[model samples]
Target: MSTILVTGGTGNLGALVVTRLRDQGHEVRVLSRHSPEFPVDLRDGSGLDAAMAGAEVVVHCASSPRGGDEQAAGHLIRAARRSGTVAHVVYISIVGVDVVPLGYYETKLRVERLLEGSGLGFTILRTTQFHDLVAEVVDRVAKLPVALLPKGVRVQPIAVEEVADRLAELAVAAPAGRVADMGGPEIRTLEEWGRSYLAARGRGRRVVPVPLAGKAYGGFRRGGNLTPSRAVGRTTFAEFLERRG
Candidate 1:
């Protein structure tokens, strides 16, 4: 069994990945500021070397859309090289990061490039949005009397558990560089998703499609965020809502 370290082990996806790795008899170390045992922050590389000392694999699941992702990724790459023990670094990225034009997507793409040139064996898996994120958006919009959704935007949201499972698999296997993009089983518009969410919650709200400007929104409208051919995820949005209820 490999000694694996997971950054962001307390997060929605990282937590599950940690559990799966442990269940397979791998020695798992969780590196995060919130972790009691390994309270290392990835932003500044504080205490990172200690956490990564003997790790054979590092699953990078810590990322913030708010910013600082580039700095964190750089720190991680440097630390992994210094450790000289980590053989595989698995990264979770968004599916359309290269085409999406959003600031967060750009940051993710930059991080991917950093890992590619870090001289370390790495695997990058780009996946569609998670069901939890979509649910959160719907919940936020439902708070208002009229639910506002982006016009002509479509989403293919996969389950966080499925993504975690995939990450765990990659952590134990050989580094395959960039893998096929993983997408949800179905692609639906924002209005359809919002209506499904409202119906599942037994709420009656008018779903309004608001036209959003800018290249980012246009990218979304053009389906830059979707991978119709790679719809490998099994759980649909409706099923995700049912399971949560």
Candidate 2:
């Protein structure tokens, strides 16, 4: 069994990755800035070298929406390269980060380029929005009389378990560089997603689509976040809601 280190191990996806790796008999090291158990911060080189030492593979799932995803990723890559012990680095990224102008998405794109240029053996798995994320948004708005959503924005939300399975498989396999993007089994607008969510909850709310300006909304409207041909996930949004109940 190989020694595998997973960043953001306390997160939704990272925790699943750790579980999957351990289930496969690999020694898994959990790392995060906040988790006292691991206590390794990815934003700086602090505690990074120790995390990289003797690890054969590094699965990088650490990220932030408040910005600085690039810095966090770069810190990990630089430390790993300096340690020269890690064989491969796997990054979990979003699907539309390349074309989307949202601050978080832009940061994710920079993280991808940093991995590519680091000259380290790496595989970047670009996935769509997670099912939990969609549910959170819908749930927040469903409590209101009118559900406010971005008009024309669409997303293919996938189960985090499915994404973790794919990431764990990539961690064990030979690094394939930038793999094909993975998405949900269906394409849906945010309006439709919210409507279905409320319907499942037996709640009545007016789904209002607000036309948004800026490249972020434009990218989403143009289907930049979706891989229509690569819908490999088995869990549909409806199924996900049922499971959540």
**Candidate 2 lDDT (Cα, 0 to 1):** 0.88
Pairs of residues clashing in candidate 2: none
Candidate lDDT scores, in order, read 0.93, 0.88
Q: Pick the candidate with the highest TM-score.
A: 1
* Candidate 1 Cα errors over 4 Å, as ranges: none
* Residue lDDT tens for model 1, 100-193: 8999999999999999999999999999999999889989988999999998899999999999999999999999999999999999998899
Clashes (N, CA, C under 3 Å) per candidate: 0, 0
What is the C-alpha RMSD, rounded to one decimal, of candidate 2? Answer: 1.3
lDDT of 2 by residue, 116-211 (tens): 899889999999999999989988877778999999888899999999999999999988899998999988899999999889988889899999
lDDT of 1 at 54: 89
